[model samples]
Target chain A: MAIFRTCPDTGLKIHSQAEALIKANAVVGIVFLAIGGLFGIAVALTRWPAVHLLDPEWFYLVLTAHGVGVLLFWIIFFEMAILYFASAILLNSRLAVPKIAWGAFALMLAGAILTNIAIFQGDSSVMFTSYVPMKASPNFYLGLILFAVGALIGCFVFFATLVIAKNDKTYEGSVPLVTFGAITAAIIAVFTIASGAIILIPTWLWSLGFISYIDPLMYKIIWWGMGHSSQQINVSAQVAVWYAIAAMVLGAKPLSEKVSRSAFLLYILFLQLASAHHLLVEPGLSSEWKIFNTSYAMYLAVLGSMIHGFSVPGAIEAAQRRRGFTRGVFEWLRKAPWGNPAFSSLFISLVLFGFLGGITGVIMGTEQINLIMHNTLYVPGHFHGTVVAGTTLAFMGITYLVVPLIFRREIWMPRLARWQPYLFGLGAGGISLFMMGAGTLGVPRRHWDITFSDAPLSVDVPGTAFLMMGLNGVFAILAGLGGLAFIINIVGSVLIGKRRDKTVARTNPVVFDGGAAVAGYGAEGTMKVPGTVVLVATFFTAFVLYYYVNWKFLSEVWPLS
Target chain B: MAIHPPADRLWWKEPLATSEVIWIAVAFLWGLVMFFTMIYWHFAGEQNLSSEAYKISPEKFAERTEAMAAKYKVREEGDTGVPVVRPPAGTDIYMFGRLWEWWPVLELEKDKTYRLHLSSLDWQHGFSLQPTNINLQIHPGYEMVVTLKPNKTGEFSVVCNEFCGVGHHTMVGRIYVVDAK
Candidate 1:
């Protein structure tokens, strides 16, 4: 029988097997983050016209490495940890198959290492897209195949754990909202992994020359279902973490649990359709197919996000008000714990992801608007907003809480932890804004240099774009430093920070307050979230302004009648 | 942290607060409006390049482009020695994207619409028109027909934005919209 040690703070029983897996996955994720982040700094510096660090070949190589490392390896690894934690810990169930979980971990590690080796060896400098006919070494595709299969297996294990929890009758009605969010993420992971299998298995064979030809258009249409949907998994998981952090840090419950759950269900159904936006400008797809995929039913996914956008902050405000912080409408907003990394980072993630990532995504995903933004640096700017500012920051925030709860150690550098979110959020927000600005001025996304001096005709972009790229470089450095601070705090805390005494663990559970109002779900209150309503109103105003500004800019482009 | 399950585990089953329902309604209504706006833009003067495309062989595309270049090549004074082909207004024009170059600098008459047929010989490439900021993804075995009427007569550079190997950044094509005197 597996041993279960209930966390003294959260009171959720944690399986020894689950704790080990979470630690292993989180450590690996941080390692990939470090490697990918270094590559990111190089990429940023090279894009800075003043620096122009790498030559063409090396730039492409580093770009490929960076994309695979950060986007694929780091995020997926951490999500695996989250899947395990959400299921086994939150549900208070033993891991369904611990040995099988280890196997999945091994396969993932092998795949990541193999892919990196192929890229560094230079035959696989095909960038992340790896469009067919421009082939890479067989190992690149093989690596991705292994990774996807591993992740798929891990997801099944998560589902199994949920089943175990249900069968065991381990506390609850409809599985807490946090675990519900994880279930949504796990479902999306299944679809994303399947899409990867459908495309990558054949691509692996083609790379080895066993297969004769791969249609470029066919490859793109199928590949983005994997490519873009993979990000949707992150979105689902990140949103889950946001919910978890809110509840754990502030003892805040969902404003309406059913509404939040419905929004997650919407993600599983419609988020993948957003992938079609990537192929909107590609030949072979009809205007009807493009428009239908981008708008008709796809807006439901956007609606899902909008729902979460309002509800998350709304939940917090409602929680705050119940604690008697109800003097004025804005009292709840003013009384937030800005110093706690858990609160600060999640809050920043919400704001940046919505204003920068969410609004820009809607505009860019618009079929007509996609024509202008698809291949520019704007594409990267959009993702960095979502993945880095949104997902990575939220994950970082949770890690602060997780370190103490799971690892059983106090955070080592408490002072540095407080400032980490602001430094990173500000820096990352800058990167997104500057890149979008440069991209709007027509800077190419993957091009090594915008000023083609050696070419027959010298290309001259606006001086402002050069300034934007330079600023992006500076921000990358700042974000890199913030990432460094987080790593130090986490590693130092886990390895050397003082462990809690047994009495301390039992007596001082991670509760924010012992007050009945703080812990309750605010079922009896009026549920008036005036502060969040005002904040969301501000968000809408910005969204509307940015939305029309892009349209106005589109009107100035070439008159294609 | 001592864990305390919610006082009401079926909190979701409880009625939603008026505020929650109202916010959901507002967000959903906004989404509907946005969706309709896209539909409206599609019909009313949205400058998206027409999707109209067909399948083509790499060899056939290369052959037709070579023939057109041979027939219309003109070496004018101060030309960069790259061959410039001045075709008539309102004709079907072919562009071959091969290896690391977009072939045959095209010269078109200002204010006259031309149907440009674009395809790649080996790999996928991006047809990004700079200074004007129009971008389209071009791939092998597919012909993209973009009906473009150049209103401003000037030099516009077509930069290949897709990562089609290392020399992709250098793959620039030229378009000259000359005044038809």
Candidate 2:
């Protein structure tokens, strides 16, 4: 009956510890995301064949660093934070063990440290996907396995807490919209880790000569389950953010909570099965299997995407319509905040993920069509669309809306937050375009340089100018700096920033709870800040990183003996 | 479960159509690709997309290239004996491949519609047609056909794209398509 929170600064008891867990997740997510963004930049530099910032030895090491740092650690850790919010905060309950949440952070940090060490030592060069036989040092694989295992433990903790809430009968109905989406994402992560174990454990054994044969093709199949399926986990979380963002900025809720959850569940079902698409161009898989897996699966993957595309906007429309704007069909479009950082990140992320990543992913899934895009710069562009444009961008946008709520600190530079999105989106779009073009030109991926022509390769330098410019626009360093800017804002806001007035504190504790209180009208109220121009810059950094990777994957040639 | 619709639904509710119309059109195109592959395999019994009918080494391929050039055409001759040709990037080139198959003995000239019917008599060989970067798999029991025209002027490699056994990485072929006089 009573709202709980003891604010450390103002010495006020306002919200519960569960809310603290949610806020903590957001803070940790910010830190990890910035680091991951840095890794993204390094990876892009390594991938660009012409610039070739790091040597082949360091190139691959950094490539591994990039994948582990950005894809697995940063994104997944952020998802864990979201999971905390879902199980506790969104459920309108508190965390079971705040200390365990901190423990999860420590484990993730430990894993990240091991992986970075292994990579920088030049002991791991198997590329991000780490296909079999192109082996890395045992420590690298060990570090990854440990990291994932830790993440799985975190997922278990989340589920346990959710189960507690269920037992408590805290809700009058099924899980709330945001929590439902978060659970779906966590469930997908379960499969993601399980599949990863299937490949990694055995692969690690084989590297140490503990076992004899790990079929490259079979390894590929499972690895994608780890590699690609995990990305779907990212997608599920991204959709969750879309809901969160709408709730925060537009004061919107799901058009149909049932429809939204169904979409999340659909992702869980299809995403795992679709990893087979990664091996479409790989050796030893049957044509019958590849056809069944890749092409057929795209329909399912795209269907989930289409549902979100329509439903998310539909929620906005329905919410706007509820406001009685009653303008033209495009009226809701022009009136929306185009200048909010959080809005900009979500908007641009949606565009890049759906249009660019979705298109390239489908093209690569084709049995015969994969020939054009497999292992090319196009592949990086495709993933950037998903990870950078789709997941990371959305997560970043979410930060602006969430940090103020969870940390109870006003955003350091609201203007900068508003402008960062378009920069990233535009830069990434340009990179994706160039990557698709280079793929058409038969540019191979994961090479250190393109100075020498392998039999399958031909030299075409000046012709790739558009690609060079596109990548230069979005390379990882610039993106990393942008990421740093975002992280610093949040961290600074939490650590040094002053708390709001007592009236404001009493009125609301969580900054972006998204008005789920419904009829209850809980203690806290939401803020309606005017949009700013800074969101575009946030987008620029992400796009720059994408471009760097695209350039590298296209032109770089690693001298493999 | 399995929520796959019955094979004979009111085609509209079949799959992607019920999902997204644009994706439906794309899915239809993918279907056509699958159909073409099936038809090719049905006709050849085993489809291997290459122009080379005989198994030979790079050195031997050069010797055969001279012989096959007289029969067909030679585009660009290099001092290193690696001639270059442009086999439309996106099209598959099906030909017979064995451990020592002479790859692309027939050099394709620009803008020529050549149907490459391929298979292997020995261990599986790979016919990697570049620019499009599509690989035509050659197995003893499978035959593949590639329908293509010269799309660009470069030495597009016809490497043993498949790892048959030993000498897999070293196994390569070339297509040198010249400007038609």
Candidate 3:
């Protein structure tokens, strides 16, 4: 299968024979999303006065699993598609190993299952942060490492596919814009996995009593490479999808390719240092380094995002303008097809992500301002802006758009698909905002009961905020129903939808400048990968930064204690 | 498929070599401004000249009675002869030290933006503050900083949120947030 550069070329094809691998990853990803949502509901239940689901013990388990399943599994599996598309489908290539991809899938699934069992069984229930003084069963740690390994191997296959493409040379000039962002994400993901390996492997050794000494402080600094930065990875990958979807659907092209590409690349360059911003309010750190690493270095990453904000919206506006939907700045808004589920999901997700997540993150990243928001529910509220609303919702929306196109079947409930993104974003955004408010009132997270903690705390951030958050979860159940509609749609389309004789081939044979291509017929496809080396090189740098450099600091205790 | 370039290229690309020199000069001047704000701490921390932070034992604390302590000035006496380490409100309480991998091991006062300059005494410590997952690195010599407004009026646990050693789970500290006088 070669990539479709234009419609007339019967050789260029869009449908991936390796979609079984994609569907496999999607199944795993959605399962995690659903389970993570349940854990999220547990958090709401624990916080709310009505249901009271947090068992301290159970809450910890839920927190850990929620972080792993929703944040890690859901996002990463979806990102795998972006990775493959970048290296293969975008380039018109095929998988290096369809079988091994399935193997990686199986490993991740098994790891996920083991992790849930270990956590829910009350083994090692430290929250996702897994900070020191909290212990989980060795299985919990092992499960995490195995899953990371699986994800890493999946990343390797993506790289290999890129290698396969470049070797064949299916296209000319620089890599496509969407491929650039995907590769950048893959780079970040490599570092993230390395960070996980550093922490989990060491902790596993300590858990078994194999090591007499381990440093909690050391583990944490290294952990953020995976923890905080991984969030950025998801953001990068999802935005790449957004760029592709926008271009394909609405004819939106970035206002300035250099600006958008740099914006995405800037994330890779700056996010590693920016992650330390999570540590403000923590003692045993130098003011100078904290200020420099987090405060100064962080703005670069933020600037990248800010640039993205302008460019992406500018692209959309320019596209709409070209289409002659001229009314006003607001007219561009009205002209957008409101009924399109993909458009709705991507647009709203970007809005909430940038407005809510980006703003709060920059404010919280400051050294002086950090003291106010570190451990409280405000932190959760802040991230939900980007991850849940921005990344997860975008992926869900893409599934509605992508799955149907690839499967060649009508979406089972187009009406429901149209509504899912809006409902999920509303519920998540509402809940996260209230959590932030409660945090401002000095509400602490990880407490079984706020009423029981001995920590010296003031500022009663409203009780209703928790109720509001719970209400959001209730709506989330509705959103989940929307998601189920999507799954049923995919299953029905693949298994049962009436197939047309056209076979709904993916690519058009003829290509044009900054515009749509002609549709192609048949299975002939070729993948071009010009920047495969760059992608792997960036990843190599990431791995080195996380493992080799970060490990030195982590391996030895400082201040010569 | 025909791959095509944009119809127009923007005007910014045409630059003279001398512009690099001009640009470099401007960047240097901007860096100079950033230097001033940074230099004070660099010097202050270089010679262990930070004015605040210490390890106080129960005996040293108890021994600072008004009658016994007025001579040493570790604690100041009120009119009633009761001794208290009276750090005034709104003071930039600078704390720079090793937290020994456990917290409650380190105590800070309430009602101030304690400019905490922290680093691990031994291993890297992820200083996680509760109620807010505001976690930061305490790298030796590298310095992780946080400006903390202790708005709460009670004892809050400060623990090594990063998993470190065999006893990592027990690394706990407490900060006593006394009511404002």
Which candidate do you rate higher for DockQ, 2 or 3? 3
Best candidate according to TM-score: 1
Superposed model 2: Cα runs more than 4 Å off: A1-28, A43-51, A97-103, A295-298, A453-458, A465-481, A505-561, B1-129, B135-154, B157-174, B177-181
Clashing pairs in 1: A8-B1, A9-A509, A9-B1, A9-B2, A10-B1, A10-B3, A11-B3, A509-B1, A510-B1
Per-residue alpha-carbon lDDT of candidate 1 for residues B110-169, written as tens digits (9 for 90 to 100)? 888888889999999988888788889999999888888887788888888899988888
lDDT of 2 by residue, B1-181 (tens): 0001112222222222122233234434544544454334334432222332333333443443345444443344455453333344233343445554434444555655665555555544545555436544454433444455655655555545443432343455556665665
Runs of candidate 3 with Cα error greater than 4 angstroms are A1-17, A296-298, A453-561, B1-181
Candidate 3 displacement at residue A499 in angstroms: 3.9
- Model 1 gets an lDDT of 0.85
Top lDDT: which candidate number? 1
**DockQ-based CAPRI category assigned to the predicted complex of candidate 3:** incorrect
Best by DockQ: 1
Candidate 1 C-alpha lDDT tens digits along A1-561: 899887777667889999999999999999999899999999999999999999999999999999999999999999999999888998888999999999999999999999999999999999898998889899999999999888989999999998998999886656777777888888888888888888888999998888998998888888888899889898999988988887887777777776888999999888877668788789868777887787638488888888899888887887778778998888887898898899999999999999989999889988778778879999999989999999999999999988888899888988999999999999899999999988888888988988886566656678999999999999999999999999988999999987965686666555464468765553433477878878888998998888888888877776664
How far is A85's C-alpha from truth in model 2 (Å)?
0.5
lDDT of 2 by residue, A66-156 (tens): 7777788778777877887667666545566667766776777677778778777875755677655556778778878887887888888
Model 3 TM-score on chain A: 0.84
